[model samples]
Target: MPDSLDPSLPRIFLSAGELACPERPSIITTVLGSCVSLCLWDRVRCAGGMNHYALPYPFTADEEPNARYGAWAIEGLYECLLEQGSRPAHLEAKLFGGAALIPAPQAQLDIGGRNVALGLSELRRLGVPLKARRTGGQHGLLLHFRTDTAEVLLRRAGG
Candidate 1:
């Protein structure tokens, strides 16, 4: 599919019971693994959006939804920001995801680390400043945000 044909450019959708905002100031929430969820907020405009992506790029024919990839998911978030009238130079970000959810001692690959690093790098490339972040752990997260108030609620699984 062409870049413009990507599914992330449209309005919000529900996947795995999570909300993904692809336009305007919309509240979205979800859980993730090595995958990352990025929250983009335009404080001056009092608007924000979020995206939950399984992989950095489109999954291969044999792969399942790997929400941990930064490539595909980040692109979706960017498209949403643009659609919301966010000026690339005027945007700010809050990042989450990349949990080392596997039990320690058996934890090997640092998927969370990669996700966080890529997320930060992408934000910088887009000229958005990363204002806050919570990443790397052995637990899942339930995220909530209200675009009107620019408030984010983070609930850890079973907590």
Candidate 2:
């Protein structure tokens, strides 16, 4: 909550299959490789959220849609903003992750590409303009998002 890097400011660490949108000035951070982390911010409300998903699309109807899937995760974040009285048109977006963690044939099962594309498509369909992004390559990422200021700090793993 404080401008300084106060030890008291809550730091939420998103695991491989987690997502959240908080009202307080909490810092959300996560790591990704081939997976995607989509961050959405509402400038008017000074609020933001992020989701970490492993896959771009849901495979079956029988499966319960989860935050681990981009289809659900992306919309879920949008819904949170709307619920907070933030208009869809007023929201800005930033996408991260979708790295080529594996060194195999980059096309056959390029899940990373799918993840980035899916995020971009959904944001476009929602009419939310994507302002920035860091995606693709053969490395994992360390992302820090400040919810209060909607500031993001990113770095490639082991860089």
> TM-scores for all candidates?
0.72, 0.93
Write down the TM-score for model 2: 0.93
| Residue 127 shift from truth in candidate 1, angstroms | 1.5
The true-structure Cα RMSD of candidate 2 reads 2.1
Count of backbone clashes for each model?
12, 0
Q: Give one digit per residue, the lDDT tens place, for model 2 in 93-153.
A: 9999999887767585999999999999999899999999999988999988888777888
List the candidate 2 regions with Cα displacement exceeding 4 Å: 1-7
Question: Model 2 clash pairs?
Answer: none
CA shift of 150, model 2, Å: 1.2
Tell me how far the alpha carbon of residue 18 in candidate 1 is from the true structure, in angstroms, after superposition: 8.1
Local distance difference test, candidate 2 = 0.87
Which one wins on lDDT? 2
